[model samples]
Target chain A: MTQKPSRTQALYAWLDERLGLTTINKLVLDRKVPKVNWWYTLGSATLFLFILQVVTGIFLTVYYVPTPDHAYDSVNYIMQGVRFGWLVRGIHHWGASFMVLFVFLHMLRVFYMGAYKYPRELTWMIGVLLFVLTLGMGFTGYLLPWNQRAYWATTVGTQIAGTPPIIGPWITRILRGGEEISALTLSRFFALHIWMIPGLMALLIAVHLYLVIRIGISNPPSKDE
Target chain B: MSSHNPHDLSRRDFFKIVSSFVGSLMGLILGLPLISYFVSPALDEQGGEKWIPAGPLDNYPVGEPTLFTFTLTKQHGWEKTAQSYGVYIIRHSDTEVTVFSNVCTHLACRVRWHDDVSEFICPCHDAHFAEDGTVISGPAPRPLDKYEYKIEDGTLYLHLVEG
Candidate 1:
């Protein structure tokens, strides 16, 4: 008679049969890569920052009221009253700026190393889209605080978008919900910041990670090739 | 292979310990703050004391007590709320004034001034207090609360303490 496998081993075997968990571990966590420098870590760093932003942003929504009247005061309460709220918000605030910086740097790294060529071109394209979404998040989130600087910054930002011809004005009106900044504009930006943009970015990030794994990390570019 | 060598094996063990420590450190750095962040609202407290203006001293007629009501706007979380407070003011002179809170000392019900009975009457529980706010006949255990006041220039100011 064969001896029974241990409980954990049996569970793992059962899961492996249905979910192919071992295959996933082998493909994702144990995959081999060519020798690379610290520059390769930039992409992962950006992803880490994105996760941080999502967590802190959700915590903020606990106290954050999207209305213009309450927005500034709510943020004030979070900073002053809520314990460690300042830290959470601080991480999210700095994380946004750093994510933008890291995404740009990661792209620059890929560009310089010529990692965007060949089979990785689609991944590069998706990453570029992700970069645009990152900027979109920053733009929408900047207005949520509704403080003096944020209010005026958004005003000028929308005005800049209104600088073109007829279509430019139309875009501005759509963004602002009218010819000027109003409560509707704030709620619209809030929706996009919390839901729409992040949702799209998450979908794109899954694709980006998949592509990164499928094509595997590119070899450091040779001087000739 | 070097992978099986003792020296390489110890180096790998060192890396495992270092990575685990760093990973746990990262979790601790964020995890503790996150616990506080979620439970913060329960820990919030807002209170203060300040001298609030009760308008010009000339507004109150000397001799009898008059109900003087003032409004205070306070920051309650995200809202600015206007709380109305009242005090019975007895002006002995332009600078000499006695201020008694409109609240009954017993159950915190509002006590109205009865000119005929010459006392503050608490309608909620049939409690009464003399003109000086001493409990006359009721379940009240103490006199009406008094507030400190001062006169500067033409304006009369009263101290507001909140918790």
Candidate 2:
């Protein structure tokens, strides 16, 4: 006698009939990766750091106040009052630096391996944009603590933005929302760090992954293609 | 089949058009509110800049810049917190008062008053400011900021704006 289909199989088949999820799974899972060394893992490590940032960042926002008035005290409360808040925040902080580092290392590996050339040009371009987004995330996150260093560093950073040329003052004004850094600047940075850059990063990351899967990971440079 | 009505819409095309319209309308409905919410913080005026009571005017003596520590209750948007502020209140006379911020002009490091050395020293970079808050010998591009102050009813109040 024939047995009934398992629940998992039934649900998957029902969805797969409409979504072609099985084809997707086969496309993603059945692919062959290059026989590269462990250096190939840097991209994955960077992705892991991004996930860590997202998780820890969500935890942090539960208590963190983006306003300058309460930002420092809220951070202090997280450190002193909340259980393991320090650990979560510490990981988030260190994870930001780690993400930047890992992305840089991944790009360097890709560049040295000549992965940016040929059909992978778009991937390299996306990688560069992602790298920039990663750095933007770091720069914006640095000010969330609302400490003295953050305040002054942001001041200097904005001033640097104001040094370009005809658009320098405009750049600074747009960033700071005025001639100087104020609560608006903090809010702007908070929004950019938590939403804007991360949103763009997520979309680009999807595209990057799609391109990677489409083109396949390039082999380490050799005389033969 | 060849005698179909000209204005007749196919089911699939009708669904596609209706769904597209509904999707765009939903996106607009959701996106406008979110954009407004995101931009509202910037639009709301930061209402913390005001004159805060520092202390009694008699607490400061003549010729010596006394450090007056005060707590400012600040409200920025929905968040409210008390932040500690310090300023050196120097009384040249009964009417002349010069209040210098303890924050170093270079990098905003707290400057310490050293009576023994007769100079305000920023420990971060070993920068020194004179008793008059001049950049005596240091990397400080400018003198310590002179905070605005007002005396009312023998009470000292600082025009606290930016840190």
Candidate 3:
């Protein structure tokens, strides 16, 4: 008589049949990255920073208040009152800057390598979109503190957005949620910073990663193809 | 793929229906609280005016404006915050009192009472406000904001928004 498969083997076979888990592992995890130096890691680093930002931002939201009246005080309370709140906020604050910096550096590396040329145009375009989204996140998050610097800086920033040829005024009004910055502006910025931009970024990042994997990382510049 | 027997097909269909029902029930069990947590802030009621007692009228000396500080509790969504509010109380007479917000009109800096200069000086932009809350000099675009105040039974109450 034929022997029955072991319990572990049966379970694995069952999962593999439905999910093709092993095939996914072979295609994704076992796929080889180019044997370039440390420069290839910046994209992954930027992704890591994005995750860190999301986690810390979620923690901050527990105590943060997005309102003109209490935004500043709530930030102060987070930085001072909650346990290890300073560490979380500090990491989030610095992580945002690092994310922007790393994304720029990664783009620079890709551009310098001419990876944007030929078959990788779509990848490069998605990357550029991600860069703009990162900037949007920074701009939106800057106003959450609602202090003098945050207030005036946002005012000037929105005014600059109001300087474009035809769409300037509309952009400013949409960003500010009205003619001037008020509680509505704070609410808009908060929504964009915490959810909308991040959600779009996540989707774009997934697509960018899929494209990169499908196209493969471009080879380093060399004499031969 | 292989063809299945009718008896086996019916059994599989029953399992599929049962699994989907269980999956939907599980999703409902997990999703309701998360949805509520996300929407709680938008549904919060955080508006209304509350008159806060700054201090007694007798505490202020005549002519010389004294700063009265009071704690204003603000509620935003689920968070309750207490911010210190300060106003310059100028007692002109026994019944007449003028209260000016310490916030500078130029850039919202806290203006302090300078006894030597005899005018409120904004260290931020060097703006000056006279004892009567008018802009005396500097980049201030308007006079200091006068908060609505009322004196009742020797106690001075300021009409402030409590979240």
TM-score of each: 0.68, 0.57, 0.57
Clash pairs, candidate 3, are none
Highest DockQ among the candidates is held by which one? 1
- State the lDDT of candidate 1 residue by residue for B1-163, as single tens digits: 2466655667647888998999899889998999888887566675679998888888888868889888888766778799889999888887799999998888988889998878999999988899888989988899999999999998988988877
Query: Candidate 3 at A2: error in angstroms?
Result: 14
Q: Could you tell me the fnat of model 1? A: 0.84
Q: In candidate 2, what are the lDDT values of residues A158-195, reduced to their tens digit?
A: 89889988999999999898988889999999999999
Each model's fraction of native contacts:
0.84, 0.04, 0.00
Give me candidate 3's interface root-mean-square deviation.
7.5
State the displacement of the C-alpha of residue B96, model 3, in Å, after optimal TM-score superposition. Answer: 50
* Window of ten residues with lowest summed lDDT in model 1 chain B: B1-10
Model 1 agreement with the true structure over A33-112: per-residue lDDT tens digits: 99999999999999999999999999899999999878988999889888888899999999999999999999999999
Tell me the whole-model lDDT of each prediction, alpha carbons only.
Answer: 0.91, 0.85, 0.86
Relative to the true structure, candidate 2 reaches a TM of 0.57
For candidate 3, give the lDDT of residue A105: 98
Q: Which residue ranges in model 1 land beyond 4 Å of their true spot?
A: A1-18, B1-17, B45-76, B80-163
lDDT of candidate 3 over A53-118, digit per residue (tens): 987789789879898777888788766655566767888899999999999999999998888999
Q: Rank candidates, DockQ, best first.
A: 1, 2, 3
lDDT of predicted model 3:
0.86
